[model samples]
Target: MLIKPSTAIRQDYTGLAELCHSIDEPVVLTRNGEADLVVMSYEAYRRAEARVKLQARLIAADRQAGDPTALLDATSVFDRIRARIDDAEA
Candidate 1:
């Protein structure tokens, strides 16, 4: 999908809803040269909105939990995760 500039959208909003419905994500609502608004399907929008809310709650909970699992080093995390998958396969 072409990243639509905000000006063009503002001038031609007649078919915006139809276009938005057909596409997976909302047309990029740009302000100036930068993207500002994301257009997406209603279900996608709801899922995204819910995910953001869930993330905030999760973050607050983690903070309250005093950073549990803080020693998870990324370098070894993949190997650890892969080991779990290997065990599952076996």
Candidate 2:
């Protein structure tokens, strides 16, 4: 989920293994000031990576021909719907 420095990880090798087995989220390892490795439960990692790739594809699709703001700015629509529901009951 969050980036962890390698040194901190190496200090707790057993803990790391247990954490890897226990957690579905990836634990990133930093090396030389950059993210070098990611450790997670094997099956979980595969699934998460696949999802990430799919998300990337979706983002690419959005970038090529869609408005990113449409999904990002729906508060006004939500408020209007809420107001209509309140008025209907009144």
Candidate 3:
């Protein structure tokens, strides 16, 4: 959705909000004929944030996978985490 500055400023917010809720992509709000703010649904924002985080995690994991020193069995990792948690609790 492309919104002109005049329409965005003069129109009621309900229509804009409705469009945001219904659409999957972000609504671009233009000002002075240039790109301005972006409007998107809460769920869309959350999903995008999650995807970015997951991508970062995957990249980190890929880097670690190439480093033999960083490798560890799942059980040892869980045990180490549990020990840390127990130490913190104590």
Candidate 4:
């Protein structure tokens, strides 16, 4: 984890931005010696968001798999997913 004083941002916004882009990770900024905010490249934020979404989907799938009442045959599931994709494309 990269940690920087909040003053660092006010002092060198460009350098901080470059560090975020180069590291592809978040930089923690502290104020009064306490953690305050996190800064990251927009691309990194988007990737992190995507990972969270995928994890949620996986968890939901696992729960559904263990529930007999929610079970759906593989063919039906795939057909419904494909239909949704087709609709999205159209």
Model 2 stretches with alpha carbons more than 4 Å out = 49-90
lDDT by residue (tens digit), candidate 3, 1-90: 655463663596787777778877688878788887888888889999999999999999999999999999999999999999999999
Top lDDT: which candidate number? Answer: 4
TM-score of each: 0.45, 0.44, 0.72, 0.80
* Cα-based lDDT for every prediction: 0.77, 0.82, 0.82, 0.97
State the local distance difference test value for candidate 3. Answer: 0.82
Question: lDDT per residue, candidate 2, 1-90, as tens digits?
Answer: 867889867699888877777776789999999999987878886897799999999998878657656554478889989999999999
| lDDT value for model 4 | 0.97
Candidate 2, residue 73: the lDDT equals 46
- Give the clash count for model 4: 0
What residue runs in model 1 are displaced by over 4 Å at the alpha carbon? 5-18, 30-37, 67-90
Could you tell which candidate, 2 or 4, scores higher by TM-score? 4
Error of 4 at 46 (Å): 0.4
**4 Cα displacement, candidate 2 (Å):** 0.9
TM-score of 4: 0.80
